[model samples]
Target chain A: MLESYIEQLQRVETLGELNDQVVALRDTLDVEHVVYHSVNSTGEQYAALTYSPEWVQRYLDEDYTRIDPVVQACYRRFHPIDWKRLDWTNKNVRNFHGEAIDSGIGNQGFSVPIRGPSGQFALFTVSGNASDDKWASYTQEHVRDLLLVSHFVNQKALELERGTDQVQTVSLSPRETDALTMLAMSYNRAQAADSLSISEHTLRVYIESARFKLTAMNTTHAVARALSQGLLII
Target chain B: MLRYIYADDLHRFPRLARSMFVDRAKQFHDRLRWDVTLRDDGTERDDYDDANPLYVIWEDTTGGHGGSMRFLPTTGDTMVNDHFLHLTDGVEIKSPFIWECTRFCLAPGAPAQVSAALMLGGMELGLNNHLSHSVGVFDARMVRIYARLGWGPTILGTAGQGRDATSVGLWAFEPELRPRLLSRAGITDEMSRHWYDRSFGALTPTAKPALSA
Candidate 1:
């Protein structure tokens, strides 16, 4: 069944077709909802969801995005995360949770955070109501499939939004590449500087330069981008 | 010793679970002033608990529960999705390998090391079960605790102030990382002897009897 879903997803060449595939995938999983949301580096956004239109409207009307922990957490992560791990301790958040449950949004959620071309950030999530053990087995059973589907969805979305592949190759100077590689290898600045026979300040310059080139959010982000893009070898 | 407990098996340690619940009522309701509903029995039970969460408990020699925490799969009922979904800006996370940890509690007067011991046990459980991550919403103050314990969790969400300020994060546990974290935290001593085993379901397994020792 998932094989068919993947084939259908691969065949989708447009956003409208992709939305239908997302809904079909959601039904195949037998979950309450499946959502694919993305924000490109340019700040343009797209979303495909199986949530009720009423709840979606309410979410927008209430401006809940500012306080949504899942979105906040996903922004910081580079891998998939479970919703149960997020912090929901505030009173307002607890109230919002109660209202969501009342609105039939399901209580369980898992999201895979995707980092796409040009710093595009996307998330794929599936939510439902089930026992912890049952949910555990279900997610365990389907995580790989879900991950594949997420990437496929993001790739299609990226293609549609950009109208061309945006994976431009980036070039880094030898020093900048070495700095990023050392940082990626878990080397502290002082150690990296010592290894490279450069001052910490010089190392920072290379790192900052590399970060700017990659448009990374920080030094770690810069390192990640370098590694993911094959611009630096560990 | 660190023992895993499930909600169904909670009945086995009636006194201990009840004590922990009362402690939670005091810690969250009274001390933290969290806006959680409390039962007339002075226990704090919520819908998530009803979902049969996996729990890790640390017990001292006097048959008392010293410290404990709760676990739930992200694929099921979790606080972050139902209530704090707004915090994620509508991102939903459902993963089998990621579980949620919550209701971390330490009985009054227990040694500080007990908290670290409880966490170590939880890490062991995840590692043994091949679980990749343990996720939770914690007080912003606990960030220091994670750093001190060398859990090295990635903060997924920024700290937010909503009465009780909290941060969401996940700790990735690889088998190789466990010993490193233990040594970094300087936790060389083994955990206490009593554990409540609920990870395997109703058939409880007790640690080796220690009378000979």
Candidate 2:
């Protein structure tokens, strides 16, 4: 599962592709469903999935998305979550869960939250019939991979939607510029620091310098400013 | 350090790519080339310069960096090139797979290293896959740069656009000569980490290895 899934998810470059992977995983595990849900910096919702026809139809026909507990809870939280952990005490939620399960969505599920700048938020989730123990193991082993996949998928989607135009709002140094560029291209700070052959502390210094120059409030804003100004190209 | 887009660098990459592309656009405009910029959302682009590879030049031999360009592959996938490059009359020309270089500019008092990096990277991307050849119009002052990099002449319809005689010079040729310097230097399909303090992420799977004393 790990090896094959890793290979398939490696080249994923859009939110659409990431959703495809989730759907694939659900089928591979012979689970009830799989879903990758994302909200961009603009709060636009994008999703790819393999839900039962009944639930999908119901969602569209009745607009259950507006009141779905999964959607509401996932948005409020900041971590990978389980469906069971959400506020399912509501009668409507219980009824929806019953309907979803009846339609073969299974009772056990897991979700991981993703964060980005400009209010970009996303959730990757899988659901299936399984013992609590089994679900726990599955998530622990694959959490890191899922987190990475979600971001790459989201990145491509953003690119497709954002296109390739930039504004100049900041001035960064070559090294600082390089560090931020690597990070912008999706390398975590640690990976970027390693690529630059400098200590993480040094990387932090460069990032701070860039952030100040851009007048950005945080690391993400600095990246945004640098990108807008054409100081770096991914 | 240098980096290439791959699968590992996904986490936090979308924002990174968006930033980098934006910065690249500004660099182009700053250099007196074409003014190509990204939209505010920072996701999609559709300007005159979209048909290019978005290159940054760095000269390691002299510790300098400046200039940027977008390299659009004519060889790898004509569809991709046309998607960005407005081939209005349609790309119905005889030449099918040709790369288009666009939105190029350099900073004032730029370093030789920046040009070197751009040249190497552009050539590498050209040779990395199938490309009929490369094409672009340049200011007369930069004509020497293109010639030094080995791009010139050929069989094609004349494209004398705009009154600037230099801008009217349209040319195309195969990348058969010397774009493979990168693969030769042992930088193949492995993941790369391009260091830019700008805000952006990775294209491939980027794993930061633990440094041991």
Best by DockQ: 1
Chain B TM-score against the true chain B, each candidate? 0.82, 0.46
Fnat of each prediction?
0.00, 0.00
Best by TM-score: 1
True-structure Cα RMSD, model 1:
15.7
On residues A14-87, what C-alpha lDDT tens digit does candidate 2 reach at each position? Answer: 55666677677765555577777777756677878888667789878977767776776556333345565556
Please tell me how candidate 1 rates in CAPRI terms.
Answer: incorrect
> Per-residue lDDT tens digits of candidate 1, residues A6-38?
546655777898899888877888898999998
- Cα lDDT of all candidates, in order? 0.69, 0.51
Question: Which CAPRI category fits model 2?
Answer: incorrect
- Regions more than 4 Å wrong, model 1: A1-234, B158-163, B181-213
